[model samples]
Target: MSKEAIVARIEKKPLSMTINGKKIGPIDVPVGMPMIDFLHHYLNLTGTHFGCGEGVCHACTVVEVKSDGSMVDTRTCIANAHSFDGKTIITIEGQAKTDASGNVTQLTPIQTAFIEKFSFQCGYCTSGFIAGATAFIDRLKREPVKRADLETAIEEALNDHICRCTGYVRYYEAVRDVALATPGCVIGQEDKR
Candidate 1:
């Protein structure tokens, strides 16, 4: 076989998904293209930071809403764009409500808490932290953790995420505050009543 015949051509596939509450794609994407590149190059949603690119830093995290409505933190740096086909994903930009003018009208509790607590320094990892924490909060709403387990729960939820600045305390504290403030996130409170 000639060298030209030995080299395989890159295949393109139609990719479509709902991102940040908007339906996007069915556009042709090269197979094996990372989701981060798809989000940045095709959709222009730059809020999902590309950190380690190896999927270890968690800075590329986005929330994938499952069919049952449960959310999971998904890493875009390593996952192929086609892997998200037909899925519902929420990036950091989607966490805030916007007006017709594209101005942010309201930030989700998790986002607000992160800002208030100064949970990030350079802010590169902030998006992933927000996405992970938001998913944790959503889970807590469905299945409240015992008050005694709140600390452990928070740690477990965010353990995989890495932040180079601000240590991990502020992020944990911010999520803790949000979970505690949100009604039904903790279970033991009812026993006290």
Candidate 2:
């Protein structure tokens, strides 16, 4: 389609979805608008970063809860907000654990690891990393990683992310540490955590 044709098709509609455990919207938004824009401008949840504005960088990663209750990381920059209407989204803000009394208690393991390992520099990519890491750790919990394939598993999980600063080693180390610390997740694991 021509640029003008695509531009002419930009639409507006009410958006409704579950964000962080809260019900949001039935709010109006442009149909073709990027999910990142809706997140920042409409919802005022700005933690999801805007990096390349293209899908090349995973800085805008958000966890999409599938119908089967499985989760995966998705890029928002290249996706239309309307496509997420019925889906449950977990952004960086949702990654934190909440207490029984509805108060937020502690950060998720990935967030804690990031701080401990000093994995981020400017922190623009930290949100995305958290999302990806959460998904990775969750996946391991569901389908445990074999010890023999531990390194490859971690690499495959995080390879999609792009971090501009603080060197990649720290981020990888943090993930490995978290994985090793979790029991029954990493098969035949040593206590590297």
Kindly report which residue pairs in candidate 1 clash with one another: none
Query: What TM-score does candidate 2 get on C-alpha atoms?
Result: 0.88
Which 10-residue window in model 2 sums to the lowest lDDT? 184-193
lDDT of 2 at 96: 87
Judge candidate 1 against the unseen true structure and give its global Cα lDDT, from 0 to 1. 0.92
lDDT of 2: 0.86
- Estimated TM-score for each candidate: 0.92, 0.88
State which candidate has the highest TM-score: 1
For residues 1-193, what per-residue lDDT tens digits would candidate 2 score against the true structure? 9998986777779989888878988988876889999999988889999999988779999998888887899899999998888789999878888877757799888889989999999889988888888888888989998777777888899888998885578988888888888777788876644
Could you report the Cα RMSD, in angstroms, for every candidate shown? 3.5, 4.3
Where does model 2 exceed 4 Å of error? 1-10, 98-104
Give the per-residue lDDT of model 1 (tens digit) for 1-193. Answer: 7776554465789999999899997899989999999999998999999999899999999999999999999999999999999999999888899998989999999989988888889998999999999999999999999988888999999999999885599999999999888998998664331
lDDT of each: 0.92, 0.86
